[model samples]
Target chain A: MSPVHLEAVCKLYRGRQQLSWRRLLRPQPPDPPHIALQDISINLPKGNVLGIVGRNGAGKSTLLKIVAGTLAPTSGLVQVAQPVAAILELGSGFHPELTGWDNALLGLALLGLDAGASQQALSDIADFAQLGSAMERPIKTYSTGMVVRLAFAVTTCLHPEVLILDEALSVGDGAFARRSFERIMQFRRDGATILFCSHSLYHIEALADRVIWLDGGRIVADGAPQHVLRDYQHFLDQAPETQTPALPQAGLARGHAALEQHRIPARLRRIRVNGQPAGQAVELTCLQSTLRIEVDFTSDPSLPAPGVGFIITTPDGRSITSTSTIADGIVIGRDVHGSGTVILEFPDLPLLRGLYVLAVYLLSEDGLLVYEELPQAAELQVHSPGPELGYVLLPRRWLPLGNGHAAPDCKPSAHRYIRT
Target chain B: MRGVLLLLRRLIRAYGQGFYQPWQLALRHRHLLRQLLGRDAIIQTAGTHLGRLWLLLGPGLQILAWWFVFDAVLRVRPMARFSFLDYFLPSVLPWLLVQETLSRCLSLLREVRSLYERSIFPLAILPLLPLLLVWMIYTPLEAAVVAILHGPQAALAATGFMVVLAWLLLPWCYIFSLLGIFFPDGAYGMRFLLTLLFYFTPILYAPQMLPENLQDILAWNPMATLLQQLHGLIGLAALDLHHAWYPLACSLLVTGPAWVLFRRMSIQIREAL
Candidate 1:
């Protein structure tokens, strides 16, 4: 039998509306309701680990609570083949006044153990909690971390058939987290079906066999970990970034055409990568061409040899390229203004489709750092070329093996490709 | 009926595992329940200087206040056949026991809501703890009161018969304990309803004080009937077999329904908590 089967489940929350005296005089219909889950169906087999990921308020917690039997669905059925245990919230069943040992017994009792069995389980939980003499003291006196430790110990001792953990691992220190990770692995190895919810992508990637992405209280995507994570990341990227003021006239033309069409007022407009806008100044995309980066800066005549530097990095903080005016042999001291437009043109962007942040540095003539922007201004996303593979594409030439290859006459091409 | 009997037997087995043999579970978890009760007592007595003394003192004051209200303020006549204190003590002590046990059982779950969340603690034990505490403290106090008001005869009668009756009906305490966990508001509402029940019962007044029709209705009050039987045993009133049988039968009738409700609700109480 499957560990869990949820069929045609739907949860609806009724919204309350305040009625005025005048409105109350007449009959009024109920306010519209919010649907937390709609016709959701899921089947989890034994020994499988499923990770649920979603933005805040996406009903992931609700789904877990339903499966834990902490909540009953408004409609439909949830069938479980075995006894299920959930760490829905930390310290949920522990009595603040109870000692750690007492709580361990209580935990076992809740699992349907007899008194003798519960007593036997207490020692194991006590050992795991490692509170020593403090286990005899009231739990209310314990620190938050201590409470979490005790709760975790008691839960892990249950040897539950199906373990559902909702963000429980995010608690505790580094060492405890490592130990907990080991314990989760052990539980998995023992063939316990585990459902984990976490915002940590790394943990999900490492621990989960499958991932379900929830959006607007609905399952937007569900599949293998990598596939679902990719979809979720894309969903996050497309979500509206910070609302910005309108853009300036020349700035509007240089900005992405998508930005130019946005109804934002000229002054309020700001550049955004995913959902967050650039902190510094805005960099404009070339009009009608997406090939390279172009910077337009107003130069101050007082500052000489004003050097400009541009650094591009992937969203995960991998440095793609860093170039400065000095490296390009542009002497800012000789220029009339301390600052001038420094354009770094790459005829072919080497970066694969991914989100990238740009950083710009403005320097004085004597190579004194005047102003530096680590990820200078805003974020940019290079959209995925459908079905493209490889982290980067390199421009290379192949010549015939023999040295006597005929020389071919060629015209000066407008495009130039560089390989590093 | 057979299925119910089987389920009852199972429940009894489950409960028996924890009942008298505290060491079976308590040896390991003695620290746990102790800490829970200690913490509860501490928080309950925080602002008060006397601390746990308040547990004894609060009930003491309640008994004193009730004595003053009934003996002094109303100056109501006692039952035609007995001393005022004798008539009042037996009835008041059992009434106090019933109220304390039932009220505590009802709110037991709400008082331990946090403990319920910690998945490790079984919620069933929550209701039991309060009742257990009440039994420990109030049982002795009730005996002391009986001995004081009516001397050795009343004390011996209560110790033998009334005490046994209370123990036999102790299962009611467990039933109410489960009810308390299942419906927190239900406890408060029942407490309020018990105020009306107190007047209907012959706690402060003689049963014959009312009209015959009213006497018949008041005679049907289960707690009153139990009190009458208790008073009769203590030599404060005549033993009315007619009144005695009704309460015993009613108590029996209540047991099945209470057990069913308790078992059914016990499964859901943890979820509610």
Candidate 2:
């Protein structure tokens, strides 16, 4: 039997509506409830790792709550074969006034362990958390990462049949995270069913066997991680446009033929790279190398010297950078009227290895009016030799410091691992 | 009798599960409960030098204040048989227990909210924590006071009534806790109401001091019955069976429905948090 099974589950929360003083004498109608999850069904066999991916308020946490049995669904059946543990939030079940040791025992008791068993489990959690004397102190004094360590240790050591982690490992040091991942792997080896949710696609890709993508309280896609993630990425790329309409076909030639035929104002006709028409894939050669993008478009005759620009953004529509003809302080002469090409080039791009989307736009010469915009006009995949953190990579020179003094032979492995 | 047996069986089968599961969980995790209670006990008196002695000090001060107001200032005679101090002590002890439990009961939702959501632990037993903590602080002081003034018999009577009182208050505690979640202002409202109740009940004066109609009205008030019971136990008043019956019947009626409703309502109320 599957460790967790949810059928036609839905969750509705009543909005906390305030009634005015004038309505005190009258019975106020109850506020409509917000639908957090809408008729969602899921089944997880033992040993399967299911990842939930969604934007904020997409009901990912609500789904995890239902699976963990912490929440009863509005109108459906939830069946779980084994004991479930959910790390919904760090320091959630802890009392601030109580020491970590005391809280740990309470947490275990909540999980249905006897007093002797909970006491026995204490040493294991203490050792695993490596909190040392901090376990003796009240939980309010402990840092967030320490609390997470203690929480993670308690939950993992309990040997739950079904484990649900909802962005629980987002905090904590790298060593603790590594230990947590190893423990999860060990749980998987023991045929435990796991539900993992996070905003980080990297963790999802590494851990999840199946992926469910939620959008506005409904499942948009669910399948193998690779297939569902690709569809989810595409959705994020053009989320505003529900469906991708066909782009108008244009001439193959470059000069007057391609320009004059495209009389439409501020429409992106074609994109080129190094004097060649860039097709299907655009790879950003990321060895601190320069990359150039040429956007060919048409502008109306009346709007002279139209501003052509391109914006580079992440898949989630966060704009990283944008440049326009007005911003660059370049004005076209009166003779150039019908159509033109705007060239945007990056010299030694500092962006780390990741997927990025480029959006091209046409604006009035002053650059205030956006005449047209083509979001996700091009996709750039950066490849790098080393796994780097964040968007940009910084240049560095290694001058080893030995014993608080600059020395040639010594290395900074200890300092470097702290970041990883 | 058969019909009543069936109903009792059904009640046990249905509400008993809700009742037993949390208690069982509490027993299983008694170590945790001890830790939690111990932590709460220490923290209550941590900043003060006298630690835990404040339990006695607080009630002692209240007794003194009441004595000063009724005896010295007003020169009022509440009872002919007993001094005002002796008359006020036993009634006030139980009154304080009820008052403290009611005040804490109103905020049970807020306290449980902090701990329940962090894990999948059954939080059904959490509401009882405050009551137990309050009992832990007051029980010892109560024993000492009863033993000192009224002797061993009074101490035993007070302890016996306290157990009965806890059972009487449990259902209302759960009901108020659930209400506290919906109305965060319920705590303040209860404080206001309990203060009015203290005056209406015969804590500061004897019921005989009032007119017959007022005495008739006060007899129906549950606190009045409880205080009368304490007075009877301490040899201050006769053990009036009718007064005792009123509170017993009222609590039984309230507890039966409250327990069932609390079991059902708590499931949904948790989601609100």
Candidate 3:
């Protein structure tokens, strides 16, 4: 049997509609129940990783909650293998006033660990969270990152049969993120079924074997990660820009509290593309126009300058080309006050036709934690003439054909592709 | 005979199906229950220098305040052989159990909804939380007080009666918890109602102190039946068989329906939240 099987699962939120006494005394029609999920079905075999991706309120968290047995579905069947541990919300199931050690025991018990196994799990959590003596202190005193670390540790330490994470993979960066990434990888190696949801398509594509894209509480795409993610991005691209801009990844706001104790990390102050404002769309000739992106940032004088990245992607959210300050070994010089603006210039851009999106990201001093993302910073509309179909036009050298003799109109240059 | 046989069959069937679910969930999550209760015990007395002693001491202070009003200031005494504090002590001990459990039940589900409802802790087990916590705190205190005042025999009797009283209050735990969740107004109203109930019962004054009609009306109170059972068992009041039927009948009448109501409202509670 598949480790996780869901059949025709539907969740309708009929919240307190006719429950009001005032409504009962003088009755009016109740509002329609919100359909959080509809006709969802999946059969995930053991050791498989399934990724859920969707827009905000697209019911990603709702689906995870149901499968994890937190919320029962309104109708239909949900059969998940037992020993399912889920990190639905950060620091959930943890009492703030209780010591982290006590909370871990409680969390393990809720996840169905008995007395014998709890001791080992508790030790593992203490080690994984690296809180050390902080484990003896109440959770209220720990920073948010420490809480997430503890929650993540307790949830994953048991090697649950089905591991569920909702926007939790962005646990903190540097050693802990890498440690968490390795632990999740270990869960996969140990044949644990992982159900992961995230706004980062990069992580989803790298980690998920199969992906399900939810739209309007229904499964719009489900298949191989690349195929489904492409389809979802295309769907989003075709959609009008009427909806509000999506919220940045939730982890972007994390670590600020801890950082406050030390120094302010780098943040995107301003950006300009080819002398145009970052908000407006800029047109560029495929090979004739130079794509110049200038970025300004400010950070604490004591801290080193933060790294910056420039990414260009298709309208369907697929990255075609990327570069960064750290990758090129370029150290941004800081002024006396540790604030500076640096310009990145690319002469004669070779991007092909069609509309594209570019985003500038700011990383911490360690260059592992992505502190902020200026998503959709600008639209780069590349104009390429002739019949070229794809993201980039690679430079080519056509060797002499027919002993260096070539026709004038259909010359050796005729076979040579002109990008502009 | 037919009705008795029918009750037997229903009891057996309930035992087979939904009746034991709460118990099973309790056993399944027993460790979590221990941790939660332990945490509550610590938090209740943490900031105080006295620590866990405040479990008994805090309630002791409240009773001291009452003693100043009724015994010292008002100079009230029961017509019975025992002093007013002696008359008040045994009954108030049981009343403390009811007050603590019922009052906490008003916010029990609300407080732990996020902690348990969204996770594996069965929501059905929530109503039992207040009962168990209060029972652990007050049951021994009642027996200790009885032993100190009366004798060993009455203390033993108080222990047995408190256990029985705890069982009888189980259904009300579920009932009040549901009421609190569905109607928040019930929580505010229940506090005032409990205070009125304290005065209405014979815990503070003798029944003869009130008019005969008021005494007649107070006898109809279901809580009075519980208090009467406590007094009779400990050899303070006459062991009246008239109030005996209510405790047993309330348990049998309400246990099944309360469980059903809890199960029925589980979905609604999640949505409402």
* Alpha carbon lDDT of each predicted model: 0.64, 0.72, 0.79
| Candidate 1 structure quality by residue, lDDT tens digits, A1-420 | 698889999977655433345456886876788788888888998998999999888888888877887666778889875577788877776666566776666666556666677778788777766778998887888998788878787677767788888886434542354355567668889999989888766468767889988877788888999999888766765666432322222231222232234311111113332234445333332121244444444333433435666667655544567777776787643234222344456543555556666755544333323332334455655544334454444444555547878544322121332213
Residue range B223-264, candidate 1, lDDT tens digits = 878887787877777776676777667655555555445545
Model 3 C-alpha lDDT per residue in residues B183-250, reported as the tens digit of each score: 87757889899988888888888778999889987776677787777777777778887778866786
- Give the distance in Å from residue A379's predicted Cα in candidate 3 to where it truly belongs: 10
Candidate 2 lDDT, tens digit per residue, A263-326?
3344456777545464434676455556688876665556566777776776665556778788
| lDDT, candidate 3, A345-414, per-residue tens | 8777878788888888876554545656777778988887657787777765555678886544432222
Error of 2 at A358 (Å): 14
RMSD of 3: 6.9
Any runs in candidate 3 off by more than 4 Å, and if so which?
A242-309, A313-347, A351-420, B1-12, B15-21
User: Which ranges in model 2 have alpha carbons more than 4 Å from their true place?
Assistant: A17-23, A240-420, B1-32, B42-46, B72-77, B185-187
Q: Estimate how well candidate 3 is docked, as a DockQ score.
A: 0.48
lDDT of candidate 2 over B213-251, digit per residue (tens)? 788888668988888888888777777766688887776
| Model 1 DockQ class | incorrect
Of 1 and 2, which scores higher on DockQ? 2
State how far residue A250 of model 3 sits from its true place (Å).
15
